[model samples]
Target: MKQQTKQEILYRFPDGFWWGSATSATQIEGAANEGGKGPNIWDYWYEKEPNRFFNGVGPSVTSDFYHRYKEDIALMKEIGHNSFRLSISWSRLIPGGIGDVNPTAVQFYNNVINELLENEIEPFVTLFHFDMPLAMQELGGWESRDVVDAYARYAKICFELFGDRVKKWFTHNEPIVPVEGGYLYDFHYPNIIDFQRAVQVAYHTIIAHAKAVQVFKQMNIPDGKIGIILNLTPSYPRSSHPADVKAAHIADLFFNRSFLDPAVKGEYPQDLVDLLREYGYLPVTKEGDQKLIKENTVDILGINYYQPRRVKTKEHLPNPEAPFMPDRFFDYYAMPGRKMNPHRGWEIYEKGIYDILMNVKENYGNIECFISENGMGVEGEERFRDEDGMIHDDYRIEFIREHLKWVHKAIQEGANVKGYHVWTFMDNWSWTNAYKNRYGLVAVDLENNRKRTIKKSGYWFKTLVENNGF
Candidate 1:
């Protein structure tokens, strides 16, 4: 009788679960200059040097969602998207970051929001998604306090305009990407290599985020919630040795805790502050910043987990004459026996999602959060197309399933996990990657009028959303 009573366990989520994908304005919306839209860093950078982008294919030739958003929204509905995350282009909305609101741009966003509502899809809107208005960059970007003030004003305007209808708002997405890609790595626009300047940029971004939260709270949009989306990469020490442990701690301070602490705990790590001060590389801060940050904390968190960072103790000392860098204290250690994603060369670590959620639950006051972005990017996917003209992307299906299993485990263990949103809904131009890597459930034919077709994983996702479980 006991054996007969046993049954398969169902990994079901709570009611009103959010099921969707995310996309940024610059990556999806073409018509870069239409509808009174000002040039952003991407637009200016492409015009200045097209070769910098992948295959010299700039943002101008994206999926043309500007003219096809209605059709695109319907596709989202068909895919069973109850909620979706979309960033509002600062360049398009305020046109130069601090001027009059463009009526045409306003109308476009209004229509998009209404369409989503009409389709019963909740809109998760982000204010800035790395598409800095070119005009703001001219004034020193985030390095200057003026840009920070302008960003606060822009956040206020967005709340006033759309906060009434759009309850979920995000200040910025992956704020550290600019510091890493632009200043440290030279992968983003206005590329430079300066540790001191990078410190300043990162500091100003925190200030800007806190200020935005303050404004959002003041507006008092009914049931409105504001948060920051951080791409949290957990640091694992190579061994339990003191040196390896110290190296991992430093890396975590530099990458994860830099934003996580202030965003959640409303405080910066004392050790990091001491290190910067000892090195004489501390970024400038103003009076009342401590108070401002403490008083305004996020109501939610969006964690974008792609890969984990593995670090080992440093063997070589840095040259006294060489420039200061984050890697000076440690080096990345590629684990010999780790799962890998050969398609894109990223590590296949599904448990990283559970690790992140558990960390948030244990260390960050159990903040309400979700898997905001997770997906596989496979190039040359066209070869997998069948005679039926449908893509059988089993690799993507497996990737998502493995990750969702961990998510289910986390939720069952009480992680306050809210939902799971993939990296994107459709294949669109990446930042400088262009169309080289495709990470979408729907494939866009780059050559054939940018046609859209659902991949195998998309159909599976629709079923998963409808069933709320596998």
Candidate 2:
């Protein structure tokens, strides 16, 4: 085989391309219960079953961003970061998720936002990041329509509190992850396996997003944009057979179109609605929901693409007696000769990002978008020790370079992409997986007072951002 050189990469992004890193409050901020922060779902869940987490680690012992944010921001500026994305915990703001505001938490967030702006770094703030307040979860969570209203109110409070400094606001992060992890996979809190409940939860989340957008519009905040972050997984057929094609289409509808259409177009896809009606799994909707959704679509989009789905027709027939299942119509097929992430067992196909951008451009009106979260996750990464007590993560550098090449290609082909933010800034506690998978340019040492060290990828990313491409 012939070799392709770096100059062979044909595309370059526009001037002022945003190159930064992202992290959630609950994942990186270790002051879990301090500063008037009440219990979130993660805190409550960990208290119940500590063994469920990897290495028995929980959010209480995270990257310690609460105390080290000033130093971290300095590092961000030193590494050529012009922007950073972070989330505000709902329970931290409103302990009961609905009642009075917490003064200490308010001051802390204001300080963080003001500090970011003072340092000339744009802050992208997300409202909810899979950390539902325990009080709200007890009230039927997303399964009840009332929770949707509560979420909208919470979002409005955030806008009123932080909209002056935070120009870009995201309603939710990976909305479908809760439906799959909390409802189907039994990996998250309130774990259950009911497709009907899952459909309802998904529906309510869309409603919450629409309501939040409506509130934002009502506020009329100048030069501010509100959007939702979606994890778009492009689907590919195993073969050209009619069954395989149909399976791929259905999978795409379920995974991508289910949330993308409503967030972008203000309406769900007709095919997805038809499938739900056929299976009697359609979520109950109230009056005016259709109009609300149609009127308040997102002003921007955040795409988080990690991998694609290779699907084939299901070999087994549907069982009438069993509860509804999404995989009943299609089966996942592991592609032969596909590149793999040895540390995390995930497929690495750089083209998936390009295909995702193209799909959004062709089918979703080419909305303004950016890569919200993309990175390689490694398990037990501490074993890669060196004489200097630093991890030489060259593989991570290669992973990001391959993905950026595809993103650059998509931008050249007129895909309306604006920026790229890696999944994290430093290794922190993941929700259920805890600290097992490290997806960060900066490594955090959990021992010896939670120290942070820049990895090789961090240096590479700094130069890439400085040059706008490398």
Best by TM-score: 1
Best by lDDT: 1
Each prediction's total of clashing residue pairs, residues at least 3 apart in sequence or on different chains, is 0, 0
In model 1, the clashing pairs are none
lDDT of 1 at 384: 94
User: Per-candidate TM vs. native?
Assistant: 0.97, 0.97
Q: How far is candidate 2 from the true structure (C-alpha RMSD, Å)?
A: 2.8
Where does candidate 2 stray beyond 4 Å?
Answer: 1-11, 319-321
* lDDT assessment of candidate 1: 0.91
Candidate 1 has its poorest 10 consecutive residues by lDDT at 1-10
The 10-residue segment of model 2 with minimum total lDDT is 1-10
Candidate 1, residues 1-470, lDDT tens digits: the string is 01111133266777888999999999999999799999999999999988988789999859888898998999999999999999999999999899899999889999999999999999999999999999999999999999999999999988888887899999999999999987888899889899999999999999999999999998889999999999999899999999999999999999999999999999999999998999999998999999998998899999998888999999898888877888998999999999888867888889988899999999999999998999989889999999978898999989998899999999999999889999889998898888888998888998899899999888988877877877
